[model samples]
Target: MQTSVIISTYNSPLWLQKVLWGYFAQDRHDFELVIADDGSSDETREMLAAMAPNSPVPIAHVWQPDEGFQKCRILNKAIAVAQGERILLTDGDCVPRRDFVEVHTRLAQPDRFLTGGYFKLPPNVSKALTQDDIAGQQAFNAFWLMRHGLPFTSKLLKVVATSPFDEWLNRLSPARPTWNGHSASCLRSQAIQINGFNEDMQYGGLDVEFGLRLRHVGIEPRHIRYSAIALHLHHGHGYVTQGMKERSHGVKENTRHNRLTWAERGLSQWLDSSNRATLLRDDRLTRF
Candidate 1:
């Protein structure tokens, strides 16, 4: 089966390189790397272009001006041009294990979505990190977890079946399939036949909404987070920074609905980059 991996990037140049290189190490025979950059001013474009020529598989770039957090726009477009029947989606900040694709493919079925796992890190570390660094920060992480009071595990992320009516939702229940949006995921045609992601959602709800859409259409997600591990390069805080590293204005709250619109004059600055929903097919490229 042909697989297309879609990685969406903002201004995270250093992290993006590690993520792309991880793709090169995969054992899969057929796949493509689709970089949908959110207008990073760093050496991202140059680095991606340089790597494209020597790549064993195809690499394509889709870029637009910073447009807040419009991941759905890029993802939907990338899926349109993807050569693979199965679409693998992850972030520029995460690096997949060599067996990432293998695990997902093994678990994938026609009517189920696959949500893989990710290992959270601290600020700026790569997959090549030494075990000592991981051990040294164990204490720091423990304090951080207690202080934040956010739900997390040693592996950093966990998945759950969010279906309200499912038997799994009860107090005593057997483990059911799970769904979360951006670690590692594989969805078939049935999952997206209606629409991929609801572009209207701004912050965290979009992925969840899409998962709900899948369930609504009879596509239950297979809870496979811990099984297919990926490394999520760390951030200073638990949250990944969104806007201009200086201004810190892209973050939105329900009261501030204006932050959701990128069309405004000053608001566009908050958005690193964006593009209209479009599909660029291989037919547009000239042959040698």
Candidate 2:
């Protein structure tokens, strides 16, 4: 099946460039890239425009106005315009391994959403990474990370572990598998069935709320955290707050108690032909 990878980003053009380089190095190529831009400055637009011509795959930059932390809304907008049969959701700062797309395609199930995890780098490691490192896949190497100041921890095993062991660990882990925005995949139709992300949510638990709705609609969560990996570039979350977390919790509670399956305001609302045409004509979204 054709796959569309939706990368959410703001103004982190440098990290986004690294992530794109990772995609260019992927073993799998039958996919397109959709950038779900959340109102970045002109710098981001120019960067994307310059990179699109030489990109390994087709790229679409779907941007919305810079309303504060409207990630969910921009994602919905991206989902609205995506042309692939399946959609893989990730952040622009998360660089994928060469086999990332291959693994996601292999594990994709008709009635389930694939949930994966990321190896978060320290700020120093994140800053030290170059496009060459990502293209060469050194950024995902356990030894490379360790030499660059990654602390010694059991989690480090994920970088170099083999199949059965990784599978076993994923099965045995206590952490519940959920739709991690940094790495997750599902059918485009399945995402539409749930009406995409709840636009009311901020950065906190928006992904979790969307996953919960998918479960309510009978889309089971499949754990692939160990199998399909990505490297998360470290960045400060200046927008996240206690109030945001509380609000996210409240949304999660309401969805669980109410068994919400569809978002009230989602992709359907924005997919209107006239609306999409206007968005494209107004310089809000540019396809390349």
Leading candidate by lDDT? 2
Q: Write the per-residue lDDT of candidate 2 for residues 56-146, one digit (tens) a residue.
A: 7889898887878889988988988888889999999999999999899988899999999988888899999998898898888888998
Candidate 1 regions with alpha-carbon error over 4 angstroms? 124-178, 236-288
lDDT of 1 by residue, 196-247 (tens): 6545444454455555555666777776655565667775432335433222
lDDT of 1 at 245: 28
Residue pairs with backbone atoms closer than 3 Å in model 2 (clashes) = none
Span of 10 residues, lowest total lDDT, candidate 2: 274-283
Give TM per candidate.
0.66, 0.95
Error of 1 at 163 (Å): 28
All candidates' lDDT scores?
Answer: 0.56, 0.87
Residue 46 in model 2: lDDT = 93
